[model samples]
Structures are given as structure tokens and as C-alpha cells.
Target: MGLRAVSFFAIAVVSILMFHLPYREVKTAATESLNQRQMLLAKQASFGIESFFKEQRNLLRHFAHSPAFLELSKVGKDVIQEEINDHREFVKAVTIYDKKGIIKYSYPNPEKVIGKDISSQAHVKKILREHKANVSDVFNAIQGFQAVALSEPMFEDGEFVGVVAFLIDFKHIAKTYIESIQVGDDGYAWVISRDGTELYCPVPGHTGANISETSAQFPSALAMAEEMQKGHSGTTTYQYNKIRSKITETITKHAAYYPVNVFDNLWSIAVATPESEIYSEYQSFYKKMIFATVVLFAVLIFFGYTIIKDFNLQKLNKELEKRVAFEMDKRQQQEKVMLQQARFYSMGETLNTIAHQWRQPLNIIGLCVQDIEDTYRHNEITEKYIAETVDKTMKSLELLSRTIDNFSTFYTPNEQLTELNLYSFTKQIVSLLQEQFESLNINLKFDEDGTLQIRKSVFFDAKVYPDVLKQIILSCLQNSREAVQKRLRSGEISKGEIRLGILRADAEFSIVIIDNGGGIKEEVLDKVFDQYFTTKSVSIGMGLGLYISRNILEEYMNGTLSIKNYKDGAMVTIKFKDSKES
Candidate 1:
């Protein structure tokens, strides 16, 4: 009797616990899903706000560069008025400031602000001196209303003319974007300046307030502001008020914030949604789970009186499952490490390419130095000549710096797939290799059927690994160079010319590289892509070029690579699945 009673009680307790496990899991999943959604919503809202400001700035830039605006005096007053009026819904006014900070022109010509010297403003000085566009800090402007400003500098023939400054009404941005967000009951969205000043919040008390105070005057607001200041997007929780049944309840809510970049200015969007709303269904789940536990306990007590053993066997089975899972995880980690190692090994090729690219610029700098001495000896070293030489040297150094950056990008692994315009990609790779090939008197032309225009070709855009694509093209160019030299030595051809062709039709794009060197022998062509197979002298080339390229295209990019003979020359074609079709 004692054993039976103990078994029944144990069964009832276990069943009750089992009945509530699912409810706990469901609650956790719901919380995570809602938090993610909240963050996503915050990001989208931030993008929208940024896009709005970007468009506005672009519009001002266009206006500043237009011929009519450039010759402001030649254009009619109505033209300026019409322009400002068109954007008046969001634009408070437009003012033009010359290099001296003097207001050259103003739309609406407000009596007090029209001739006001704004050169004293920090942002105005920044635009004038730097010759760059900028967004100003929020301020109390005309009619004592809060507003922000954007300025785009104007230049004609590379000489500074003035700046086009546009004032934006803070209320417009809030009403159009911030106030429109629909969070749960008592939830809202707001915008804050980079300094944490509340620029646009639906709550009247919070608007125009600064939360950057170090003192814990308002701890919740301070925490929220600090999170937004961290940049990009993130989520944070703090104590907040949730009013219900005519009573104020202090509860915690999740807040997500995303930063917006306008010109050089940084602003942020914050969305607050009640944590209770995220798990409101949990209350019902809790009730149903309790009822289930009661029923399960009663059933187990009546029918599950006998204790079940074999816990040792069950534990052994669990141990086996854990061991299998651990092995799988370990293997996955090893595979990842191996892939990274392969990428690291490719750095040797990247370094060599960088060396080839830097040679020209370094030679230019050396030439400039030699010229300076030669000119001084000849008594022809004028200041103008020195300045010109220095300018050329600086330009060469800039090119070298950019080449270093390109090399860094060339081997970066795990890049996202992107749409590549066949013409642009071909042009960039050809340009990079053209200098090296030209040193050997080889002509490398990237064209399509002799009819494709630069930057305007519609034929070859596909999705693939850009770094791998660049590496493959570079390899082909190097091979083409060697092929030309081989034919020249054997008295097969006098002039060396390699043509890279871009071809596209119906769901695919192909890159074809053809060299006018003697075609490969039938026997050699079959094994040319094999690892460590080389025809060039030891000092000139390594044989991994075509082999690695084929592996990359086939295994990683879902593409095929093939080489064939074409009119007494070799032609290598790489075909890719077109992204547009996909």
C-alpha cells in the first residue's frame, strides 16, 4: 500500500510539470519574435526618415547646380519664388549666402532675416570653408518654432559662388513620420537629435526635452536615449508607465531605436511598444495550462500507479544522442576553419597583384624626384614647375592608396551576392591589368562584338562573387600575356592582342577572353587547367591560375569554365547564371 501510494504521487507531480513546459516555451518564442519585429520596424522607419532627408538634400544640390540658380540675378524673382513655393509645404524658406557670409538672396525676403549675416553660424562657416554640404543643428527659428537647416555649397567652374540653405520645419517631419507609427495602446515613436534632444515625440511633455543629462533625473528616458546614441539600431528595456482601469501602473516595455544619417548630421528614430502586448496571449495560455495540469495529475494518479524503471537505459540513450550531436558540431566547425585557411592561402596571389599595381606609381614618384634634381641643375626649377610636379606626384600616390584598398577587397571572403554590370566589371579589371599588359606591348581590349558602348551595355549583368570574378579575370589576363610572349619567341605571331568579350542572351551571361597567340595543342589544352600545370618559365608564372579559377567558378559561383581554340588562338569562356532571371 505504501509503495503504490508513493508511485501515484510521483506520477501526478511529473504529469503536472510536463503539462506546463509547452506554455513556458511558447511564451519565450513569442517574446523573441515580437522583439525582432519591433527592431525591424524601427530599422524600416529609420530608413524612411533618412531617405526623406537624402531626397531633400539631393533636390537642393540639383537646384544649386542648375544654370538658372547659378545666375540668380539673371533669373526672375518669380522663378525663385516659384521654386520655394513648390517646396513650401515642408520648406520654411530658402536663403542664399555668398562666400562672405552675406545673404545674397532670399525667397520671401523676411524683413528681419533676409539681410541677416549668417556667416557667424558655425554650419555656414563650415560649408563655406570646406565647400561641402551640411545639415545644421536644431534651433528656434522664424515665429519661435523649432527647425533644422541643410546647406549645399554652390560652385561655378571650380570657384566658390555661395551656398543654398533650406530650412525644414521640425513639425512636418514628426507629423509625416513619427506620429504615423502605430504601436500598441500607449505606445509611440519619436525622433531625437544627435545630442539626445527630443525633436519629435507624440508625448507633449517629452517633446523638446533633453535626455542627455548625466544625473538620474529621469532614469528611464536616460537609458532609452543612451541606447539610441550607440548608433545604427538596437533594443533596450526600461521602466515605463502602463495605465489601465483609471490607475497608473509602472511596467517595463521594450524600446527599439535606429540612427539616421543626414549629410553629416545624426538623428535617431525610437519606437516604444508595450512588453505586455507582446505576451498578452500568455495569460490565456497560463490559465489553459493550469487546467491541463489538473486533469493530467488526476489521470496519472488513477491509471499510472505503477512506477516505470529503466531510467539507466534511457540516460544511456540520451548520452549517445548527445555524443552524435557533438560530433556533428565539431565537424562543422572544422569545415569552416578549413575554408578560412584556403582563403588565407590566396593572400600570396593578392600580394603579388598589389606589387604589380604599385610599380607604376612608385616609378612615377621616382621620376618626379629625378626631374626635380635635373631641373635644378639646368636652372629651370620654377615654382610653377615644382607645384605641377608635386600635384602629379600626389595624384599618383592617391592612385596607389586606392590600389591597396582594391587588393584588400579582392580576397575578402563571404561577401553578399550583388548585381554586377558586365561592362563596368570588365572595364575595372581590364584597367587594373591594362598597365601591366601594356608594359609588355600587349593590347588588351574589353568589348562585345565590337559594338558594345562603355557603361551602357545591357548584355552582361549577373550575381556572383565579385572577388572571385576579379581573380579569375586577372588570371586569364596573365595567361594571355604569357601566351603572346610564347608565340613571339617561336616566331608564330609579331603583334600581341587579347580581347575580352561580354555576351548575354536569355538567362545567362558569359565572359570570353581570347588571345591571338598560337592555339594550344589538342593534347596540352586538355590538361591546361590541371593543378600545377605551367607552360611559362619558372620566374614568370605559377600554374594555379586557371586551376583555382575553375574550382571557384564551378564549386562556389555555380558557374562553368571552358577553354577552346578559336581562329589560331585560345578562347576561355566563363558562364554565369543571370541574376535578373532569378
Candidate 2:
């Protein structure tokens, strides 16, 4: 073979390896990255729960030392009903149990079990056993309602006389978690005791469902918890609520566990994200990656053909032009294919989100249906009930329209670059899904140093167009929101902080979004911003949010978009050159 032929072979090998080899390495890294993130998020959720209980313990301690409880200890029957009402949300019921375990005083005048319990309660046993501050796990009360308690020994001059404690209704504590933290589609957070018995679950009907109720089901998580009791911490992936026939069908495939110290129990606050959704990123990445590979291969072929010709240079050049034209046409076709896929995904998600948004109205419509049904059954058939039902249905119909309008706005194709306020833009995008976030109780906050405000102002006002800025902001917010939601499910966010910070450095304004949710895995980090690279499953698209954001900011807006490890969280920075320089 000639020297040129040898060179051609080497170059061909290099091109193929370059295109193919990185994918395997990237895929492995992506898997690792996802695992690490799940672990971190689980830790955060556990810590947050632990902190909440710690605060509850401290509050109970303060009440034990308070003058009112002290007076009750001395004179007894010093009813602090007024004081009790002052902190109704926190203090469920304050009771003084005599050293003999007989309840002496009950606040708010309990209807049942107030003067009943002579002892045998777990908190009473703990006070008898340890003779100190104690917290009890959720248990069915004599009144048949689930309740948890915190108790502390009352002392006059350090002499143990009785136990003063607070009784909390189950709904109050459970609802706090329910209303706080956004759990994506079909995602739910639950708390199970150290013994693997569910103490709190958002699904009211399913509370106290024994972890081993269906021994045939949930074997993995049940076994993992058994191992966890041996002092294991971090995330463990398992499957629950699955029937063999429904494997990968109706059953939720992935469950993440985080051990939280809520009260005395080593409560596992688990948030299960459907594997289908969490792994959607991977599928998205794969599709985009395949597309990128095909395009890259075509480009390499064109490059090789352009430089080296087996025929006359003139004839080969003519053929090269035709091949280049064909490649361009192919690229356009590929883009069209990707867009169609995007539209299909978007259309599906749009429908799902719309359904979620209209749940209230739909429920109201159901209520109306029930009312008419009830009226018909009762033989009333009054105009009052009929009018009420019609009014409600009409109101719901209007809400449905508004929901459709909101979705229409979201689904509208955006392709313009116009002037935009960075802070305002971020706020607007977040506001678009504020209801969803509020329902999940996920905290999303934007921060900017006072000194850095000028830099951001300059960047948005620079030679950069408005549409690019809007697209970049929209993409960043969406990613951050998804990451936050994912972490919340993994129990990875403490205080549920999703912070966006903008800073000025070296004549560039850096817009950074940081979340306490588990940090991105190093494997996922490398190709996270790559075009068409995604970690999503059950969704189809170009996975172009980060890629497009990067392209717009770096290529068109004359700025740089980069992602970096931010301690225990992920930080994405978009650096815009100073307007003065531009």
C-alpha cells in the first residue's frame, strides 16, 4: 500500500474509534453518576426529617420547663387551654401523667383517653424505662386514631415527679411532608419505622401497610431495610407494589430509601420515583447520541472524500459537492425527525400536565355528578341542587379552558431572540410551574450578590439578543426544577433548597443554579451538556435543552455555558462577556 493509503487507514480507524469508544465510557459514567446522586438525595431527605424531629424534641423540652407546666406540677389541674390554642398546630395535646402513669390533667378537654390511660403506653413505658426525655413512634391510640407523642420528665429542683408530653395527630405531621416537596408523576414519599412497618404514607388508605404484607412483592426493599437495621446508610434501589405479571407494566419499578430520625424510630422516609421517569434521561441521551454519531460519521466521510479522490480531482470535486449536498439534505431530514419526536413527547407531557392542572376542576365535576345523583336518589330534584351542580360544572369548564390556554402558551414554538431580564425571566419560568412546586413543597429560590447585579444587567443588555437569553433561562430553570424534583424523590434535599445565584467574575456574569439535592455523578457530568445526550426513558426528543442552551449562549450569544461540581450539589454557569468588551 502507498503511504497515503496507510495514512487513510489510520485516519479511518481513528475517526471510528473517536466516535464509538467515548459512548461506552460515557454510558458507564452516567450510570455511576445517577447512583451517586440517588445516594446524596437520600441522605439529605433523611437529615431533613431528623432535623424536624430534633426541633420537635427541643420544643417539648421547652414546654416541660415552662411556667405553666411547672404550675401544673405544683397545684395540678392548672388548665392551660388558652395557651394550648396559641400553638395549636405544634402542640396537639399536653397531658400530665402522674408518676403512677395516671393522667392527671388533659388540655383542650379530650373526648376520649384523656382520663383513661393508667399506663401501658410506649411513651409512658419509655419514661418509666429510661426516666428521661422520650419520643414515641406512631401508634394506634385507644380512640383508634394514629398518634405520636413526645414526653419529658417533669422535675421540681431536679426531682422527677411526673411526665409532661405532647400528643400529635397523624394527619398534621404526615401532611407537612405531603404538601411540601414536589414529587413528579406517580412519585410519593413515605415513612417507615425501623422495624420496616410503614408509620406515615401519603396515600391515606395505605398507611400502616406492613412491609411484608405481600411477601412475594417488595422482597428487595424489605430485605434491604433488614440490612439497614444493621447500620447501613445511603440509597438502596428496590422494587415494591409489583406483581409478577405486571413486571415493567403497572408496578412502580424503582424505590429509593433514606433513613430519617423522625422522633425515636429510625424512620425510613422513602420517595419512590418510577424508574420509567428517572431513567428517561438515559433513553433521551441514547437517541440524541445515536443521532450525533450518525451525523459525525457522515461528516467524517465527507471530510475524507473532499481531501482524497480515487478519480480525477475535477470529477471528484463535482461528486464531492453532490455528496455534501446530500449530507446537508440528510442533516435537515434528521432534524425534522428529531423535531417530530420532540413534538410527540411535548404533546404527551402537555396532556399529562394539563390533566394534573385540572384535577381540582375534574374533582369538582365529580362532586357535581354525585350531587345530582344523590338528588335523584332522594327524589328531591330541586332547582337549587340543579343550579349548584350546573354552576360548578360551568366553573370547571372555564378552568379547563384556562388550563388549555396555559398549556397552549407552553407548547407554542419559541424561536426568537429578544431583550429579557435575567432575574425576571427566571422568576417567570418558575412561576409557570409554581403551583406544581407548591403542591410538592419543593423550595426554589434565586440568589444574586448585590455587587453582581450590575454584571447580569450588562449581560442581558449586551449584544446578546433577547430570545437567546429567554431560551437559556428557560432551559436552565427546567433542568434545575427536574433535578430538584428528582432529588426530593431520592430524599436528597435538606430544607429543600434549590438556589439560583448570579455572580460577576473576570468581566463575565455567571448565572449559577445550585441545589442541595444530591450532586450530579461524575460520569453523568461529562456528557450532561452534550447534544442529544439524556438520561431519560419513556420519553423521546433530541435531549437538546442543555445542548441548545450551550449552543445559544456560547455560539450565538458569545458567552460560555458550563457545568461544574458545586461541593455536594451541581452548578451550571452561563458566563456572558461584559457589554463594554462586546
Candidate 3:
């Protein structure tokens, strides 16, 4: 009887050990994974919010430097009204304050807020006293919406004049960026200011409330908020009573938080989900483990130790294989979603570029029609005048038609190749962009005058997709134009210059575009061709120009595109194998 009791006791001990060890390992692995996912979500959210604010600030800075805004009195209020009209999607209102912090001009029903004193406002005081730009915390605006002020100090002749403030709709931004974040079914993200004021929240009555005052019941939440306030990034677990559909229940949550620094103002973003939700899969596994352990013990007592050992080993191996397959499937699904998102973004950028390309031609068509009316009104309408107007109108319309064809062919694959003179093809693109660049006081120079000393005997013919090549050249010129314009705006150069030329070698020919805009930074020089990487403001660039240009050159034309810092700026070179070699 004693020997039988000892055997039973030893089997029970082994069963308990087996169950506890696997359960603990699974729990630890699950917790680590949940933490990593939460942290990644937090980081992504933080970056997006940071980028949004930076774009807004850059826009405000651009507005502040406008010639009309700088010389306010001479320009009249028409310019201000026009500016506001053009950016109504992002800006709620535009207000200009005098040195005394009294509103001197406002757009969209100016009488309501103009002449009002905002000198006492903290942000206004900072601008007045420091003569520096400031971004205000979210506040209730007289416009009857929660808003934030992005204010730039206006300076003229090295003297502070006043402030040009753009009121950005806070709720719109939250809705677009913060509210869109979802981590699991019940997870949500929230934002808090450095002062502990909730900037955004998913829960009712939580937004705009001070965290220190409202989170008294949740010590863990308060602690996490304190860490975020210090600009520390990490993950934590907390408990709070979540109210849903009139039902309240205490639930533990795992969260990851990160800080967003915008113009020296710090804000924290936290993404959290219930712990139960995170461990839902593991809960079923736990029950299965318990049941399996009981069965194994019964087998040990009845069928002997060898059968039990083999059964347990096989079960463990099968469980590991299942876990591996599940993880791989999940990872693949995530990759597919990311790829879809990238394609959508690229399409949106292409559409925007198309609109921009159409705008100038459309305006020219309108002007041509207006000219005929004006000539008739003056009683100067003659056969020659009518003929000239019709000619100009037809030319503009033809250009518009050609633009449509180019856009269509740009996206269509396997386009038939055409043999064309390389120099003439490049000169044509330069001519199209020359007038536009001249309007911005930028010189777009090609080797039209033979100043680059090209040999008359050099062969310049190459067979390629004409429309695709044109699109690539146009994108490069546009990038150079923007860079030159940036330098022009910063007063770094009195005149912006972009030079385009062709070079011939033994094995290949290259088209080189060099600009006097500042060179690319060393750190980001390599990433210039990376998708969605841009130094320019978001509204001005989507970082797809170079990326697409390089890809098309390589994939379609059997060519290459390369860029590096040249004398005073950047040089982009497009190379193709010599036509003779082909």
C-alpha cells in the first residue's frame, strides 16, 4: 500500500510541474508580443501627429513671408481675403495683429474679431515679447470651435512688426489622425498636452479635461501620464473603469505612450487595449493545456510511462508548429495591408500632380476668351486680331490635349518605343517649363545656344518611350524648380538657376540637371530616392517624384538615374546605354 501511494504522489507532482511550466512560458511570450505591438502603434501615431504639426507650421511660415503680408498696408485686404479663400480647408481664419497685439486685419467676416485685443493671451504675449514664432495649445476660439493658433512673427527692415496667426481647426486634425487609430477591436489612442490636459480621447467627457484632476481613481493611469509628461517613451499596464453602453466595468489595460515635440511644445500619445482582449487566444490554450495534463496523468497510471511521454512530446511539437504557422499568416496579412496603403497614397499624389499640371493651361484658355471680349468692347475687333486670338486659343488647347495624352501613357505599360533626337527631346521639355520657372524668377537654361560646345558630329538618337521619358524629365525639372524657389525665398540667392545639358561617353549618354539650390543633406542624400521621403513640406511634395523617375528609367528604358551634390547644389544624371550598343 505504501509503494502504491508513493507512485501516485510522484505522478501528481510531475503533472503539476508540466502544466505550470508551459503556462508560464506562454504567458510571458504573449505579454512580450503585446508590449511590442503597442509600442509600435504608439511610435507610428506619434510620428504622424508630429508631421501634421510641422506641415502646419511650415505653411504658416510661408504665409507670414508673403510679399503682401510683409508689406501689409500697401497690399490692402484683398490679398488676405484671397489667401484665406485658397486655404480654407486647413485654416479656419487668418488674423493679423499690430505690434500692440490688437487685431488689425481678419479674413472671412473681419469685423467680428478685428480690433480685438489679444495682448493678454499667452501665445500672443510670447510672440510680442520674444519676437519668435509660437504654436498655441488647443483652446476655445471665438470662431465657436476648438482651435490652435500657429503664429509667426512678422518682421520688416530688421524690426518686429506684429504677428500673423493662422487658426487651425483642432477637431478636424484629431478626426483625421488621432481618431483613425485602432489597435484591436476595443483599443483606442489618446493625446495629452505637456500640462496634462487631454488634447484628444475616445472616452466621453475625457477630452479637454486635465488628466491630473480627472484620473484620481486610476493611479496607474496617472503614473503613465507623469512619465509621458517627462517626455519618456515606454509601455505600461493600467486599470480603469471603462464605461460602454451604460455599463461600467473595471478592466486592466496595456498601453504604450510616446511624446510628440512640436515647436518645443510637448504632447503625449498613448495607445491602449484591454488585457483580456490581448490574452483572448491564450485563454482557450490554457483550458486545453489543463485538459491535456489530466489525460496524460491518466495515461501514466493506466498505460505506463512510455506512452504518456511520447504523447506529451508529440502534442508539444504540434502546438509549436501551429503557433509558427499562425504567426506567419498574421505577418503576411499585415504586409498586404501596408502595400495597399502605399499604392493608394501614390495614386492620390499622381492625381494631385495632374490637377496642378492642368491649372496653368486652363487659366490661359480663360484669358484668351477674355481677351476677345475685351477687344470687342473697345471696338478694336478686326480680321487680323480675331485670327491672332484664335491661333493663340488653338495652341493652348492643343497643349492641354497633349498633356492628357502624356498622363494617360505615363501610367500605361509596354508603350511602343520611338527613335528621337536626345538633345531636341530635352530642349522641348525645358522650353515647356522655362516660362513657368521665369514667372518665379528662376532661370531654366538648356544647351540651346551651343554654349556647352556639343560636337555637331555626335549622334544623339535614342529609342525610348517618348511620353515616359518626358514625364521623367518634367518631374526632375519640377523638383529643381522647387529647390531653387526655396533658396530664392530664403534670400540665399539673388537669382535661381537650373541648367540642363547632355554629355556623351564611349559607352553611354547622359542628361544632367544641376541646380543652384542648396545641396541635399549628407544624412538624407542616400534616402532621396526612397519612397515617401521628402525634405519639402507635405503640401508641396509627396517624395514620389524621384522614386518614380528612377524606377521608370530602370524598368522601362533600360537606363539609370543618379543624384549627388554638385558645386552649389544637387545634380541629377539620367543615363542610357548607347543606341549603337542596343
Candidate 4:
């Protein structure tokens, strides 16, 4: 009995240690993962801040370009109303200020401060001093709310005109960040102004609480805010509340800061998440480890007892053999299943890309069939006509062949480079899809003024896997064609046109596709490259066509693909290197 108790206690210690050991490893891994996630989120916040400013600049440009703003010397109440209506998202309130800093026209009506001179205000002064748009960090408004301001200097001819202030609601911005994030029960995120003032906090009913008073003490916030004042921004981790908070002990929480702009301010968009919350999975793993260790010890004791009770050890050997076999079979089965699933996913994506490639040629073939039928009906199907049609058919077939060749060669992953005529290569591809474009009443044209050649290149040099490029071009053509079709369907497009141009300038070669398909909406344009982003309910492509095409060009071919609004249409330009230049 003494030995048994000693053994049990030994087992218990081993079990506890086993559980505790993995707990340490898991905690370390968890901490690393949490740090990584916080870093990514910080990067995203930085991007969002930059994007916000870009949107502001764009809004200012919109007003600058407007005939109303350009023609009217003095902004009226009605003009402010129209501008506000046009840009509701960016414009919290459009208030036109006089040279004396008096509010001349405010859309939402600040009746109390209409004649007040805020000319000495920092934002207005900054705008006047810089002669350009000035962005402000979070601060108390002269009115009732907390906000940031984007003040653009209005100009009259070459002279500095009055200022136009677009008040950005800080409450809304903080609310968005709060609502979008999934914070742990005890974790929170907050924004602080450069003056050590807490601008926004995510906790319920705690909007104006000074961050310095919180259990976290806002040390990181103060550090980041100082950095923001110097126009520097990034993420950092720190330990705080070690003595005051129960959960913060031994846990290092991370904070990320995005400086508002180029201007000096103590304000930054800061995000904080508890390191322990992110690594909470380690605790569960530790418990399971302890249980497993205890079970292992129990099995050892049972084996010893059985060996003493019966000297027949053959049964034990057989049981061990059976258990080992069972484990081996289970592992083998799991590996096979994993491989099959992986193969299925890969093959499915490949087939989808292939389907997009096939649609164009099949449409072209259908058109040829119609052309042949029409000619026969008109008795114009002479041997010469038949020969011409046959020749066209053969050419189309050859195009499909070359597309296949390019695509098949890409699957090897590792292949030697060789000389390639980029001109002829793209020509074949365009020809294959030309008939489909014509059927959609899109005027497809190829303009190549110089010979462009690539040496020892992969599909990436061509901006996609040969087959993937086929799909991408087809998808683009299909989108343009469909856009035309929609207009035709609505009797809106009587004479639409699509143009495809390929040219070489200096060492750069470019493919420009322009179409008279009313351009994508401004709101959707920014998200156009996102995966599975689509305006239509059922899209022709998986929305990965452009995404994958871009990867091939920039990542593989060292090229660029960009889109812009053209005259009454959309223009997509793909620019790549003339490999010989390298």
C-alpha cells in the first residue's frame, strides 16, 4: 500500500509537470501568434487611415472640379447642401469659412457661431500657412462634439481664397472600429490624442474617460501619441497594470498606432488587445496534457499488476501488436484522405479556370457555324468561300493549340527559359476570342507598332498562366461585352465599341483594352480586386481571374496591371517588361 501510494504520487507529479510543460510552450506560441495578429491589424489600420486621407483628397478634388465650386466665388447655403448630399460619407458637415474665420455658410446650421471668427484656429491657420489641405487630429469642436477636420484652401484664380472645412466625426470613426472588432471580454481598444487626452474608448458608456486613469495607465498610448506628434507610426507591445489588474500579470498586451497624417499631432489611431486573451487556447491544451499524462501512468500500473497476477506475457505482446497496428492504419488512412481532399481542391480550381478559357472559343465556333449557314442560304458558299471559312476555322484551332501549349508548359513549375515572340503569342490569343467579341457587337482591335519579344519566360511574363491569361482576357472581354449587352438589353447602347491595343514604348510593352461599357461605379472600384468581389449575383468568373492574373504579372513577370475610367467607358492597361532590356 505504501509503494502504491508512492507510485500514485509520483504519477501525479509527472502528470502535473507534463501538463505544465506544454502550457509554457503553448503560451509562448500563443504570444507569438497574438503579436503577429496585432501587427497585421496595425498594418490594416495604417492602410485604413491612409485610405481615409485619400478619400478626403478625392472629395476635395471632386468639389474643386465641380462647376458649382469653380464658378461661385462665395459658397451659399444651397451649395453646401448640394455638396453634403453628394458626399455624405466624407462630409460630416461642409462649412465655408470667410477670411476672417467667420462661418459664412454651414449646411447643418451652426446658427450660434455663424459670425464667430475662428481664423486663429489651428486647422484654419495650418490650411492658410500650408496653402493646401490640412488634416487635424481628434479635438474638441468649437461646437458640441469631438471631431477631426480636413480643411482645404479654396483658391480664386491664383490667389488664396477662403477655406472649406470638412468636419470628420471622430465618434463615428471610433464606433466603426469598435463594432468591427471582436475583442475579448476583458480586452478593449482606444484612441488617444497627442495631448494625453483619450479621444475614444470602446467600452460601453466610457467615451470620455481619460486613458491615463484606466488600469492600463495608457503608457503605450502616451508613447505612440508622442511618435504620432513626430509623424512616425507603427505598432508596439508593453506590460502595464502588473500591480493593479488581476489578469494583466505576466501578460504583455500589444498596441498599434496609425499616425493621422504628415502633420505634427500627438494623436494616433491606437488598437490594444490583451496577450492572454489571444493565447487562451494554451490553457485548454495544458489541461488535456495533464489528463493524458495521468492516463499514461494508470496504464503502466495496470500492466504491472497484470504481469504479477499471471506470468503469461504472450497476451500482453499480442495486445501491444494489435494497438500498434491500429495506430499505423489510422495514420495511413488520415494521410490518404488529406491528400485526396487537397487534390480535389486543386483540381477544382484548375477546372474552373479552364472552363473560362473554353467559353470564348466555343462562342467563336458557334459564330462560324452561323456565318457558314448564312452564306449557304444566300448561295454565296462557293468553294472559295468554303476554303476561306475552313482556313479561318483552322487558324482558330491553331490558336487553341498554342494556348494549350503555353498552359501545359506552365504546369511543370520548373522549366528552362527560351526565346519567345510576345507579339505573335498575344495575337494568337486575341484571335481566338475575337469572334466572341464581334458577336457581342464589341469592336475588338489589336494595335502593335513594334515587335515585342520575351526571352526564356514563364506564363507570368505574359501576366498569367497561358491558360489563365486566356481566362482573364475572356473574363474581361465577357464583362465588357456584358456591359454592352445590358445597355442593348435596355435599348441604351446603339453604337458601342471595344478596342484592344498592344504597343511597345521604350523597353516597356503594354496591352490596353478600352470599351464603351459604362465604367464600374466609383464605390465598387476600390473593392474590384478583392477575392469573390462581384456586383452581379452569379458572376462568369470566380472573381479570382484578375486577382490571379495580377499575381502572375507583378509577382512572376515583374509587370503592372491598372485600370482607369476612359471616355464614356473603362480602360484596363497591362504593362510588362521587354525581357531583352533585362
> For candidate 1, what is the TM-score?
0.51
Q: Per-model C-alpha lDDT, please?
A: 0.72, 0.62, 0.76, 0.61
What is the per-residue lDDT of model 2 for residues 351-408, given as tens digits with 9 covering 90 to 100?
Answer: 4456567889999999888878888998999788678778889999999898888657
lDDT of 3 at 548: 60
Provide the lowest-lDDT 10-residue window in model 4: 455-464
Query: Residue 531 lDDT in model 1?
Result: 51
Instruction: Supply candidate 4's per-residue lDDT for 234.
Output: 67
If scored against the real structure, what TM-score would every candidate get? 0.51, 0.46, 0.53, 0.50
Tens-digit lDDT string for candidate 4 (383-485): 9888887887777777667667755654434332344545565666565555555655656666644433343134224322344344456567666666766
lDDT of 3 at 430: 70
In model 1, which regions exceed 4 Å deviation?
A: 1-13, 74-76, 212-221, 244-246, 294-415, 418-461, 464-582
Residue pairs with backbone atoms closer than 3 Å in model 3 (clashes)? none
| Candidate 1, 104-136: lDDT as tens digits | 777776465666688888888898889999988
Say which candidate scores most in TM-score.
3
Considering every candidate listed, which one attains the maximal lDDT?
3
- Cα displacement (angstroms), candidate 4, residue 562, comes to 11
Clashes of each: 0, 26, 0, 3
CA lDDT of 135 in candidate 1?
Answer: 89
